[model samples]
Target: MSASLREEMELIEKHEEILGERAELLEQMESRREQLKLQRKQQVKEGEAARRRNATLLQDLQKIEDCLRGRQLPPPTILALETKYWASVEESIPAWEHFLQGKGPHPTDGPGQPSRRAKQQLKTHKETTKKTTNDQGLPPRPKPRTAR
Candidate 1:
């Protein structure tokens, strides 16, 4: 064979080897791309599942709040408990007043400061008492005894 022909044949063989290496590299790249695509799809699925779980938790929280409100009673029960509490408080008032010598709520206020409704009732009672006394041939009430 001539040297020129042999050089040409060697170049052809080198080109073929480069083409084979390129094919292998391309196959590796394609496999890596497929793996990456599958990993991204799994990540997206996990994210969607987390979002659904959060939504379920939010719904459960709302249900719990609703149940709590449903179980709550009105102010009347609280008021009744308060009244009992105040009666207990009232029991302590006299002893406290004795200890404090009629100072503060035990002595001065003494639960005597009436609520608006109670004061209105008292005013009506006083007016009725005055009217009945006037109708009778009786003097007006002697200085009314201060309620204890």
Candidate 2:
């Protein structure tokens, strides 16, 4: 009976040690669970931020699309404006060409009429210079000989 009692005491001690190990394991498992929860919460927050950023970007895109839609120009009005612009350009071509040819009013003409010389200069500017040799009628001056 005494031997059986000793065996029972040793069994109780072993069970207590196993219970202590189980408690430690439970603590580790709880700590791991808490850590995972925190990580999940952080990921959720980041996901929410990303989702909000995407929503804002989508809204900005929609606004740009709206502005573009509002600013859409019809083809006919653009064509008409282009035609008027070309007509004005056609009216301006001669003046631009004349200005380039130096025959238009000088940039320094000031508030008064152009000078007569300025007008002559415009005419002379268009002509080529002529080179001429004239023979004086019947007189060739004798060359003065060098003294010996």
Top candidate (lDDT): 1
Question: On residues 4-121, what C-alpha lDDT tens digit does candidate 2 reach at each position?
Answer: 9999999999999999999999999999999999999999999999999999999999999999999957799898999999999998788678867978764445557775567788
TM-score of each: 0.43, 0.46
| Tens digits of per-residue lDDT for model 1, 1-148 | 6999999999999999999999999999999999999999999999999999999999999999999988957689888998899999988877676747733333333465754556678999999999887778766677868989
Cα RMSD of all models vs. native, in order, equals 22.9, 19.5
Once superposed on the true structure, which residue ranges of model 2 sit more than 4 Å away at CA?
73-148
Provide the global lDDT of candidate 2 against the true structure: 0.84
Distance from true position, residue 42, model 1, in Å?
1.2
Please give the CA lDDT of all the candidate structures.
0.84, 0.84
What lDDT score goes with residue 29 in model 1? 100
Candidate 2 to truth, TM: 0.46
Candidate 1, residue 81: the lDDT equals 96
